[model samples]
Target chain A: MNSVLDIAFTSNIKRVWHPVFRQFGLLALVLPGASLFLIPWLWMLSTAGKDTALIWKTPPVWIPPVYHWDNFIKAWLQGDFAVYYLNTFYISGMNVIGILISSVLAAYAFARIRFPGRDILFIVVLSTMMLPRQVTLIPLYMIFSELGWINTFKPLIVPLFFGDAFSIFLLRQFFLTISRELDDAALIDGCRRLGVLFRILLPLTKPALAVVAIFNFTWAWNEFFTPLIYLDSPKLFPITLGLHRFIGRAQIDIQFLMAMTIVSTLIPIGIFFLTQRYFIQGIVITGIKG
Target chain B: MAARSSLADFVKRRFTQRTEDILTAYLCLLPWIIGFLAFTLGPLVFSLVLSFFQADLFTRNIFVGFGNYIDLVQDPLFLKSLRITAVYAFVSVPLGAATALAVALLLNQKVVGLGVWRTVYYLPSVISGVAVAVLWMQIFNPRMGLINNALKVVGIEGPSWIFDSTWALPSLIIMSLWAVGANMLLYLAGLQGIPTHLYEAAKIDGANVGRRFWHVTIPMLSPTIFFNVVISLIAAFQFFTQSFIMTNGGPNNSTLSMVLFLYRKAFQQTRFGYASAVAWVLFAIIICFTLLFIRSSSLWVYYAGEERDE
Candidate 1:
């Protein structure tokens, strides 16, 4: 929550005599670097709207002569992106609900309840985070195939309902920050444990919940590996898979590829901009307190 | 001591409370426990067992008992993939951390439109996926690509990145650095948390800027740096998506990451047992490095208010 100007150890007395000089110097260095960071995005925007002839033009054009915005329409139509978008939304929606419910309940218990073997259970949860998902891919694939869940959203969405390690850990940290007195007072007023959670705790942790939701949504939206393995049907492919398939099939059209890439990036970028404050706060809390 | 006794008292009063705290806790944890058993723990143990047998999707699983693992050691492709991943992980972890820390240091200084700058720098990392991979693949194109075109202006001919074996792995490493903003943000957060008084104190003690940075800023920031490094290391080891999308272990399998190799084995070739063995090897390598990091962190990572046992 610290303001940008509230930075520690930035101000040096030696440079205090010429504050204006220092500011300009910092600006001179930073502006170009910031622009450098933004080049790929600007390039993406430029490329997505360019004419096919200009795509191969040597000394690549910075600005397209005529902005062919229909490339977006063309890419969408050609790639079956509507279906991919719908499938991605469905999967992301299911996962967000699943993670929020399971993580909130588990996090609340870990944060507030004094129960036997709580420490060991929490350790197991933490250990799961470190264990690479690759190690479990084969068996999980087998299990899903055995249950006839392959090529369905079930393999993609069901496991998240049990909750994920990182989300549970993040929510638990946020929950621990709330005072125990709030829970105690609510309990004293005949608010049951679940009631206390719903009425008292949930409201205070909305920011954390939003953070978890945004993260899960983005992760599910951009997810490729699981979708690639589980869902073979093009109809079931999410944005990432759909885009990959599109790229593979239409290797000749650079403009369409760029347009499709933009389409795939749009939702997550929109979410990031809208929920930026909460996103930064979530990362800071996890980095410092984790 | 008081907290422990209070916890003990709370447990003693458990019977007086109509709702069993333990039962409620268990109820709350039921979903995660089930998930752990079914998805994570079960698959983990199953995969370990799977590594021992020779099983294709259609054939009966034969008990080979370390035969798959022995083959993994001798397999040139597995060894090549491991080495590629190791190099990528090792190089990227330090390179990424240093670049991020540098950017964070610059960004920490009071500048106009700080929020915009942060957003600009961070957008790439946030939007990472197939889109990113595709974008970079285009950017690294030797002919008429942004990079080579830019280099052409300077009269330097650029190599065909991601297409030449010599440059393919390096191309992936370079692409990896594009997402340094995640760690940069972490460093910025860590920097803001340091007490200004420490800087003033260091200045009063006649420490110059370089001395202050080395002695105070670094020590204070060590824990954050350590955390970033470990997470980055772990992530780099499992690096995929981009290579899968961009290179597909191409240009003579030069960019074949361990996970990509595992994926090819499992999905493409249907070598389930061999892939499972590769997975276990990757797991072992990751664990060893993580343990090494944790062990070495004691010597360098500084936590305020924590006393060294020595």
Candidate 2:
């Protein structure tokens, strides 16, 4: 009966949809869309390598007549992007470290420990995810300003130490997936709570931790508005803010601006390529669960 | 021996293992608790209170209860920003989701070099922030941009995109579609999760390709679609950095989003009270929209094995 049914139904469907045509059709449809997405990046490269004069020429150059390696150097020096790069890295590093420590502990507690108000507190954490950042932007600014944190990296770096909502939530979900048996067994074998988290749970939850770290780093590195609001001094600006400032200047060459823009984009793109698995896994986990 | 036994007895009597567990949990949660109070709850309450007063960041604090809210309703620019934001969110969210779904469906099929294709599409979404704004600024440049240059090749003249008031918002909406790869990834994950047996069953039941897709794929994928829609809608409402960088609410406030308007009010203009009011209104709108979607979700969203409340 199964063979007959398979032959009748599957074979009929197979005949109706040829594999070659289906494959060809998919490629034909997808390749155009993919190329369209590539245009901006390719155009940035093309324009960045062109002569400053040629960048704005009509029927714009898709390829530079000659590659301008000096454009990157000129743009980098022009914007003091070295300082921006260091500042961004510092911020991202601090955020990743703080997020890991705080989120891991909080997530472990929420996942494993039964405390009074645990559920209520977890609900509060979840609701904060829904609370738009704009709603708290002004008051946070005011609070930070009162503390003399404005124009310093403290405002950017310190709040993250308290544990971000998304990171904690993601880590918590991951911890719940891990068996409590491993934790209990560790405890029975004379492990402390932190020890179980650090030794047993942390080793197991490495993927989740990587996801949290990668995302926090990318977000901190790409962060523009926070730096825009907090950092007034050009010397303290991250790459995003620096790039914004670079473009705001009049008499700036288009090629040079594109060069700086490309420079600002490189690290995040490189990070994405290197850690695409964790990045996509993070998105999938959050998307499905949330 | 007597001292050790007494000490152990005292410790055990003072703290049960359950009590110790609770204490440990709270200790672990202390950082988040302090943060929640300082960053989340405190600011939330403070923002609400500030909305009632008229204050610059400094010393102009004067109580004008409901005055900021009233003024916001009457203010034309505030209303305009709301409309612009709604229109942008409504257009961009669905458009992005649909495009993402389509791409995901295409990619779900038997294809070679899937990784390369996926990476190529997903790469653009990763290079976000001010970089995206700058890249698209050049891409939409009327004279020197790729779009216009390509249009010129086809003998069609393109409008001054980000510069023209009429086209600026639409230009942004178009620019937004380029980064749908993130949503596409979500959809791909969802697609993979849908059991293949359902499709085969539909085919066996004499359902054609189109029918099989509609009956099998759509229902199965509805949950994911719903998720993407809610997330994208919320994100769209808060859209700022791009417009802030690319247009600065320009070509006559055509691209002025609620967040951008609030930014101008608070940061640029230092009307902290007024911006707080705007923020509250924006918050209310976001809540209403999210609730509306969730409330209406039962009508369309299908979770396999879960019984609907019909």
Give the winner by DockQ. 2
Q: Please give the DockQ score of every candidate, comma-separated.
A: 0.56, 0.65
Could you give candidate 1's per-residue lDDT for residues A1-290 as a string of tens digits? Answer: 46555453244444564677888999898888888888988898999999878988987888988999999998889999999999999999999999999999999888888888989999999889999999999999988898999989999899999988999999989888888899999887767787878899999999999999998898888888889899989998898998889988935598899998998989999999999999999889888775
Q: Candidate 2 falls in which docking quality class?
A: medium
Q: Identify the runs in model 1 with alpha carbons over 4 angstroms from their true place.
A: A1-17, B1-14, B306-310
Query: Distance (Å) between predicted and true CA of B156, model 1?
Result: 0.3
How would you encode candidate 2's per-residue C-alpha lDDT over A1-290 as one tens digit per residue? 68898789988888877787788888998899899988888888888899967887886757777999899999898889999999999999999999988888899899898889988898999889889999999999998899999999999999899999999999988988888899989887868777888999999989999999999999898888889999999999999999989988987888899999888888989999899899999999888776
Query: Which runs of model 2 end up more than 4 angstroms from their true locations?
Result: A1-17, B1-15, B306-310
> What are the lDDT scores of the predictions, listed in order?
0.89, 0.90
**Predictions: Cα RMSD each:** 5.6, 4.0
In terms of lDDT, the best-performing candidate is: 2
Supply candidate 1's per-residue lDDT for B194. Answer: 90
Cα error, candidate 1, residue B106 (Å): 0.8
lDDT of 1 at B310: 13
Per-residue error (Å), model 1, residue A207: 0.8
Question: How many collisions per candidate?
Answer: 0, 0
